[model samples]
Target: MSLLLDGVTVGYRGRPVFEGLTLPPVPAGSLVSVVGPNAVGKSTLLRSIAGLLPVAGRVELTGESLTAMPRPERVRRLGYLPQTLPQAVPLVAYETVFSACRSALGSWTNADTEAAIEAVFDRLGIRHLALRRLSEMSGGQRQMVGLAQVLVRRTPLLLLDEPTSALDLRWQLNVLSAVREAADAQGAIALVASHDLNLALRFCDQLLVLTPSGRIAMGAPEVILTPELLASAYGIEARIERCSRGHPIVLADQALSTG
Candidate 1:
């Protein structure tokens, strides 16, 4: 199970944001994080692969073309969570999640649906809020609920854009852990777009760094998260170190003086 992007180009209107972009095929059950500075087309890349944007390239999953698939079929195969959370609806968390599940697969037995929703809420540690209304939940809570909607789909390809932007420290770690577990246990491909370098380095199996020059660096976190690359892509002086647990950590020392 490999996700392929061959010579993909995407942009707004007639302007090209990224051109001739190609990423190495990632195997099944891998979590890949896309990291870079603001407005560097990180989100655009995910949107393109999610089939939300028109692009000139081939996006394939398991040797099948995702770009040419039908919309309903594509929805069942690809799950995308955008950066912005949805506006508060009048329904409870359970209802919201149920609606998402219904939309994803069209039809299901009532028992199966209820069990699936409960399982997802339990995995996300949000089962306590299952009865709460979305209008009453906090931003972070709503974000987790939104995640439940996506993960419940159990798609082959998962594209998340800034999934942890609204969460606190604990939830941030929780969300990534759930994503990692989903990929590992379900044999899915998870691609995340994140601004947090530390979380990406800690949880993601592979890192793709989108540079300011529109170039990309793809490899393991330790190999890609270098001082030179950080300085070039983010304009910050950073040091790579290992914590007491032996996990890699990126420490930003200072900002480089840009002329």
Candidate 2:
């Protein structure tokens, strides 16, 4: 399984966010992080791939054209979690997840659907929240439920927009670990849009950086996350250092003035 984007362009009111964007084919079981400063089109990129936006070119998955596929078929193959938190509704966590599971896997037996929901809740350590109402939960808790909704679908491709944004450090690690495990075990591809460079470096197999001037860089974190890249992409004077475990970490010293 692989995902390819060729000459993909997305915009609002004809103002292009991504103009003719193309990327190398992403193989299955790879976890890629899309990182860049605000308004650099990270969300737009994921949205286009998720078939939620209009595009100019081709988006293919394993030789099938996602852009041309029927909406139901495309949704079955791709799961997307937006950056916004799940709505605070009257539904409890378990009920919400069950609804999501039923919607995606309508043919599944009730027992199987319940089993999947339980498994995802256990994996994400959100089982305790199962009985809690969404309206009573915090933003972070709601975010975790949002993720569980996607995870239970078992789609071949996951597009998560800042899945860890509202999560604390421990929960952030938990979320990324779960996502990584899902990708590896299912031979699926996950594209996560994140602002946290450190977590991306630690958990992602590849990094897709969007620069302020509209350049795109894709490679291993060590190869693509250089001081120069940071300056150009984020307008920061930064250093890429290695942690104790040899993971690359970005150390920002100062922000560079655009003027």
Candidate 3:
């Protein structure tokens, strides 16, 4: 399975942010990180691929055009977590996640839904929050609940927009680890949009870099995340080094003079 983008064009107000952009096919069972400076089209790209935004070219999954699929079928095939978390309603955390899976299945029984919800909650280590009302939870707790909702859907294509934004350091690693495990276990294609360079490099298998000009570069993180590329993309002088554990770490020493 693969997700392919061919000549994709997206914009707002009739002004093109990126035109005729084509990406290499992202293989299934892989976790890829989409990284770029703020205001680049990273989120837009995910939204366009999720069929939330109108796009000009083709977005395909496993040789089938995603846009041509019915709305429900499309929904069943892809899971999208937006940058903004949902508003706190008078709903419990488990109920929200269970409802997401129920909606996807359309006619699943309560027993089945409960079983699925429990499995997801356990996987995310949020079983304790099962009965907690959304209104009573903190922002980070709510964010984790939102992630559980997405994970319960079991969609083959997962688009996560800053899923770790509201999370603490521990939950950041936990969420990314769970996502990677899901992709590996289910053969899903996961694209995560994040601002944390080290996190992306550490957890993701492939890096899709959205340059400041809306151009893209794709490869292993170590190869693609050079000082020159960092300077060009972020206007920073960065040093890519290995920590004590021998993992790559990017140290940005100074901001470049772009003017």
User: Can you write out model 2's per-residue Cα lDDT over 1-259, one digit (the tens) per residue?
Assistant: 9999999889999799988888999999999999999999999999989988888898999999998999878878999999999999989999999988888778999999989999999999999999999999999999999999999999999999999999999999999999999999999999999999999999999999998799899999988899999999999999989889887889999999979
lDDT of 1 by residue, 1-259 (tens): 9999999989998889888888899999999999999999989999999899998988999998888999988999989999889668879999998999888877677787888888999999999989999999888889999999999878889999999999999999999999999999999999999999999988999999998887789999998788999998999999999999998999999999988
Residue pairs with colliding backbones in model 1 are none
Q: TM-score, each model? A: 0.98, 0.98, 0.97
Cα lDDT tens digits, model 3, 54-137, are 889989999999978888989999999999986788899978887788888887788877887888899889999999999988
What are the lDDT figures for the candidates, one per model? 0.91, 0.94, 0.91
Clash count in backbone of candidate 3: 0
Angstrom error at residue 96, model 1: 0.9
Model 3 misplacement above 4 A: none
Q: After superposition, how far is residue 63 of candidate 3 from its true place, in Å?
A: 0.9
Clashing pairs in 3: none
Which stretches of candidate 1 lie above 4 Å from their native place? none
Which sections of candidate 2 miss by over 4 Å?
Answer: none
Instruction: State in Å the error of residue 91, model 3.
Output: 0.6
